[model samples]
Target: MSKYWNEEIECMSREDMKKLQSERLVTQVKHVYENVPYYKKLMDEKGVTPDDINGIEDLHKLPFLTKADLREAYPYGLLAKPLSDCVRIQSTSGTTGKRVVAFYTQNDIDIWENCCARAIVAAGGTKDDVCQVCYGYGLFTGGPGLNGGSHKVGCLTLPMSSGNTERQIQFMMDLKSTILCCTPSYAAYIGESLKEMGYKPEDNKLKAGIFGAEPWTEEMRREIEKSLGIKAYDIYGLTETSGPGVSFECEEQTGMHINEDHFIAEIIDPKTGEVLPEGSKGELVFTSITKEAFPLLRYRTRDICVLTREKCSCGRTLVKMSKPMGRSDDMMIIRGVNVFPSQIETVLIEQGYSPNYLIEVDRVNNTDTLDISVEMNAEQFSDTIKDIQKKEAELVAAIKTMLGINPKVHLVSPKSIARSEGKAVRVIDKRKLH
Candidate 1:
């Protein structure tokens, strides 16, 4: 079996995958009932037993778990094993003081590592390739999860743990790292750094990138690939789902192939709570059937996506989901059309402006209008202020062409926008909704 974005498991027959999911679901239900008291109580409160969750198709009968539920349980509330049994624990960044934590038994960690190895292999990675992971470690799951996975794949792994771009580049050059892992924005920063250091893309060691933890557009992907000389692939996951590696991109590069044997994915309308069929746009839900330390049932991911069971060019039988266009929580009802800030980023990048931009929404008279502030690159500074004004007009015109809405464009100096090392706050809404 070739190690690439599409795995041998992806090509499994539909009947086989469903049967496997059914067996795993039953096993996971029993595992949770016997280990975690919190889940047992939840199941009991609903007058349901582990046997009630017999098959993957019956998932809707069970209670849905949310991030808020995980927060309430905190560190040990939902753990399926005793503290000693769990070899590792990871927490959300907790930027707002309330963090969702997850635990991993030694066996759980091994499964996670294998999934990551499969992801690497799917993206054309081999044991000889050096893996440089730039995700943060400690309570955050990105670093350690991928770190373990890289090693499992027999690659020399670099746990860079985000930031320190210069040092990251230095180590990359020294080690000749072929696989890069980090947020897409950070990858963009690294690409800019390479250019500033007078390095040629062909001479650099990077081959492919596994990017996630932020919402990005296909336009951004083309920009990254063009600048870095690497095919940037999307990885979908969270701490609740055992970090990244839940799904991965294959050589087809169309969409991410979900790991059906481990996690059952579903799409549903957040308002009506009805399951959306494949090809329908809605929020993504995941039920972890193989996770041991913290198995989540019907966990609402809040990511907006479309699921498709269509066969891919790759030989994998795994289901594919579109790249998350935005989060349900992050969707803004502007005027009439739904607007995601990444939409603006896509437009700005396409217009040859800096990707660093912001959206300020406020009420004008009675209607809401959005003011988009974009940073001008150094290349545009040599011109007069009048030229800058004309440039802003051109940007506004371009955004309209792309998003089908007109927004006020404000020109700012280079480096005016906040540098986002973590989650980027793109919108500031001041309008009052009735």
Candidate 2:
């Protein structure tokens, strides 16, 4: 059971990794400039030619691609390879105007699976393990990405898509699943379900879990680990960048390691678009160097995090990225204060409330209001009105201390809030600022 899937690439020196990225980036840029007219137009407007981008140092000269750009480009605008060359397409679960669709050739899928294999192996997966993939299949990238990776690792793979909790548990107990892959929220729900079924955390055979696809706090990770009796690892990715194996946590559990051979990562000031120095907290940007069907150059991920080349005990030389703090586009601005749902979640978990909570923001009479509905755990749920009000006030004060703004807190009964099988919807903003 080796700790790494590919030791040569994962442990490549910084100098050699940069050289590989430069070569791939140059060839990828030329391919996109020659084939993708929409990206070519953006590069032309920015006065950047393929020759202008010689290596990673010149990456800042390229135009940034945002979600809006993807929407504007629509179905075929950003396709670098021809339709015949593309073998599959995975879409973002965004419910907004246009869903982001990413295309992949067979080679692209192979590379993506290899990236995911690195994630699994880093999590202590082996050929003898049973990898249960509960992420949604078909269009969603989570299931397919981990599924292919499990196959590549020669694990006995179970393609159990999201939802159907009872069946999931039955399969887990029967087949003795060793590795579980899904979003963090869903993992929590599964842990709760197993406990309710009179099965202790030690009863299940699951040893490690890979959770991602939503923003979660460290508190939630500890809670899940306790409930499931497994070491929880975080995997980070987006559909545009070839899904959940872009980077992953190793045994060190410090931060996720980015696969620099396939993609180059950069952090930039969100407002000014200036690339930030290393260890600076800023928006994350990714450039797909090896992607064939859809090689996005300087794609603005909008995720707020910092990257560090700090050496890891896991022995991989890949750069480690802090778990995303929040999204620049999703951060709520109320009464001129920036609030992220993760901040509220931290308070909830610390206050002995369930991680499942809803933040509703609305504007009334030219004033913004913040209201939070938190789920009280079975032990915390109370029957008396005064007791509930007292708990709510305590949460209000705690959240005020954390966010610098008071919010009306309502504690609901246990399991009152809807649980999501996919990315959990934590915030609902009714203000029409657009």
Candidate 3:
């Protein structure tokens, strides 16, 4: 039998799940329309009202909320509860223009933690397991979200925030941590560090890892798993949607399952805003049906991927989202061809190159130039210049086949590329600078 934090909810029939979602969505729509003036104004302008949305079926009628809307609303415009009622707040990293702040009441926190607990349980975590959470803490949601979920699972929780890699490994070895939680890039770096420390995968006690907070390729996943000798599961969420527990990967490893009981998901054409049929690739949208302090109705997530109801071996009835193809904002147009960083990473890993690389896009004489600097494997370094050139040529050929664009591949020495303790900065688009 498959194990789950909430078996009934996870395995609920489609009919029952839809009914539950319908009821919660109606209540949530009414709550937002009544409490949030900013959303109320949006509804008024769109000629939509809470009564118009009787259930999830009417969700598309609601005005969609975008990052631009959140920025315009700023701190308090979208808040559905009073400050006194809210117990906590989490903000986005603000690497971009403005940081998005989301509030959570005690009840909201409870529901969010419950969603996270389902993720932990789905990743083979239990009260007996030691969960070491290393996704940054404080204003960022990743650390706190997973930390609370670990507690909910009754695991021996280690609230070790991100960074201090050497210490992260020490705790993992000393406590025999069974579940590792952090960004996929950090996990990859940790795997590299373990080898440097003369520790084999078997020397550590980690059985599974829940990695997220950034996009990672399946090739990168396999690399981390082989290095750490553990299955690396992907978790997905954003601060707007109440952190990292909105969805999680089950043992199937095919895709991440959305917590449909708490949130309703949809796919829409990014440009046309038309909802697509199942299995169609488009922008992933979400509606929080159970949040109290901050409720977002039909929020555009900008992640490009497909949703599938196809039978999964894990037996979770929740809809599964393919690993995101790319964020709409992150997809670049190079010489009239669309390119995603993930596409480049996929080619690199397939060519036996390290995931560490830099993509530089620039306009020269009105023509877009794509140049990638890839870190060479120390073991594969050839002494002869001709051999090195041959290696670069081979990579260029492989990338061309994958991306349909010719890129200049420059091979640098191993470990020359700076390692990222957080989300790796892989792209430097000089075209934007011009």
User: Over the full model, what C-alpha lDDT does candidate 3 score relative to the true structure?
Assistant: 0.92
* Pairs in steric clash, model 2: none
> Model 3 shows how many backbone clashes?
0
Q: Write the per-residue lDDT of candidate 3 for residues 59-175, one digit (tens) a residue.
A: 889889999999999999999999999999999988678999999999999988888899999999999999999989999898999999999999999999999999999999999
Give the lDDT of residue 56 in candidate 1. Answer: 81
Q: How do all models score by TM-score? A: 0.91, 0.98, 0.97
Estimate, for each residue in 8-90, the C-alpha lDDT of model 2 and write its tens digit. 99999999999999999999999999999999999999899999988888889999999999998988899988899999999
* Residue 310, candidate 1: alpha-carbon lDDT: 80
Overall lDDT per candidate, in order of appearance: 0.83, 0.94, 0.92
Q: Return the top candidate by TM-score.
A: 2
**Model 3, TM vs. native:** 0.97
Cα error of candidate 1 at position 406, Å? 4.8
- Total backbone clashes of model 1? 11
After best superposition, candidate 3 residue 297: deviation in angstroms? 0.8
